[model samples]
Target chain A: AQSVAQPEDQVNVAEGNPLTVKCTYSVSGNPYLFWYVQYPNRGLQFLLKYITGDNLVKGSYGFEAEFNKSQTSFHLKKPSALVSDSALYFCALIKAAGNKLTFGGGTRVLVKP
Target chain B: DVKVTQSSRYLVKRTGEKVFLECVQDMDHENMFWYRQDPGLGLRLIYFSYDVKMKEKGDIPEGYSVSREKKERFSLILESASTNQTSMYLCASSSHGWSEKLFFGSGTQLSVL
Candidate 1:
């Protein structure tokens, strides 16, 4: 079965500093990776996806994710963090020809102003 | 913009009571999904429907059922509400393709006492 792993439970960063959330995947064949953000009392919003293209995929809210095939990692990154950027981040993936998408445990990002 | 709307924002139910969580999407998505979000468990897929009247069991489908009579709507049913079932329920929709990203509703926080 395909699965995703988010190592960090929470990440704290100062405003304007770079933010990174790590993710790794275990699946057979190629993988379709995605990043989503959920605000307080809100559903998740799609940030970006990596299907088959450039290794680096850019997403909404100035966020970006890098997909590495060899390492089986898709890490989300933001060059400058904002207080409003603090939210729960999730990394999900679907294996090639798979019907279901699997999600990781998630990581909470706290941007302090 | 794609919009997925869940009927309730919060709900409280007693044990053994049947609970219903409704979801509707404005877009004519071919796939709809129901997932439960817990504190550490990011999102666990409960059920999904690929077409009207066609439902599939997800990873955690025990004690849960689904109804998809219309393409635009999908409902998750809890046969008997239990305290362990108390969690945030999220509904999402996506196009037919496997690489497509999902659009999620605001989610319904269901508390089973």
Candidate 2:
């Protein structure tokens, strides 16, 4: 079965500093990866996806992710984190034949001002 | 914008009560999903439907059922609500495969008392 792993339970970053949240996946074939953000009292919002091409995928609110094939990782990153960027981040992957995603145990990002 | 709406943002139910959580999507999506979110567990899929009247059990389907009578709506049913079942239930929809981003609702926080 396809699965995702998010190593960190929480990540703290000073505001205006760069931030990264790590993610790795195990799948049967080439995977379709995604990043989602959830704010308090709300459902997840889609941030970005990596289906085929372009390892460096840019997404909403100045966030981006790099898909590394060899390492089977797709880590989310932002150039300059803002206080408003603090939220729960999840990395997900769907196997070649699956229609559902296997999500990582989300990472809480606390961007301190 | 795609919108997935759940019938309730919060619900409280006594143990063993029959509970139903409704979801409606307005984007003409072909896939609908029901998931339960718990702290430290991320989101676990309970069920999903690829088309009207077609449903599939997801990773965590025990103690849960689903109905998709119409293309625009999906409903989750808990036959006998249990305290352990209490969690945030999220409803989402997607156009097709997992490569497509999912549009999620604000989630229903269900408490089984």
Candidate 3:
């Protein structure tokens, strides 16, 4: 079965600081990885995805993720995070031939001002 | 912009009551999914439908069922509401490819008393 994991339950960082949310996955074949963000009362918004292209995938709101094949990890990164960046982040993945997308436990990011 | 709309933003119900959560997508996507979000547990897929009147059981589908009578609408039903079932419910729609990103609704916060 394909599964994703977000090791950190919560990550705290100050505004304008570099923020990173870690994610890793386990799948049989090639994986299609994605990142999503959710505000307090809103649904998840797509952040970025890694299908089979460049290792570094840039996404919305100045966020990017690095897909490390050897490490089996896709960690989200923001060089400078704003206070509004505080939200819940999820990492999801789908196997090359699968129809369902499996999501990680999730990581809560708190960007203090 | 793609819009996936959930019928309710918040709902409060009592135990043993049958609850219905509605979702509709403006985009003519082929896949619609229902997931529940809990703190530290991320999003767990409850059910999904790929076509009208076709439904698939997701990871957690013990106490839930889904209906997709129309191409643009999907409904989730709780056989009997329970406290454990209280959580944030999210609805999403995506096209018919494994690499397609999902568009989500704002979500419904359901509280069972």
TM-score for chain A of every candidate model? 0.99, 0.98, 0.98
| Candidate 2 ranges with C-alpha deviation above 4 Å | none
User: For model 2, what is the alpha-carbon lDDT of residue B38?
Assistant: 94
Model 3: residue B71 alpha-carbon error in angstroms:
0.7
lDDT of 1 by residue, A26-109 (tens): 998899999999999888999999999799999999999999988999999999999999999999999878999999999999
Q: List the residue pairs that clash in candidate 1.
A: none
Model 2, B1-113: lDDT tens digits are 99899999999999999999999999999999999999999999999999999999999899999999999999999999999999999999999766799999999999999
Candidate 2 has an fnat equal to 0.80
Could you say which candidate leads in DockQ?
Answer: 1
Query: Candidate 3, clashing residue pairs?
Result: none
Query: CAPRI band of model 3?
Result: high
| CAPRI category for model 1 | high
DockQ of prediction 3:
0.87
**What is candidate 3's lDDT per residue for B1-113, written digit by digit as tens?**
99999999999999999999999999899999999998888899999999999999999999999999999999999999999999999999999987999999999999999
In candidate 3, how many Å is residue B11 off?
Answer: 0.8
User: Candidate 3 versus the native: TM-score?
Assistant: 0.98
Stretches of candidate 1 above 4 Å error? Answer: none
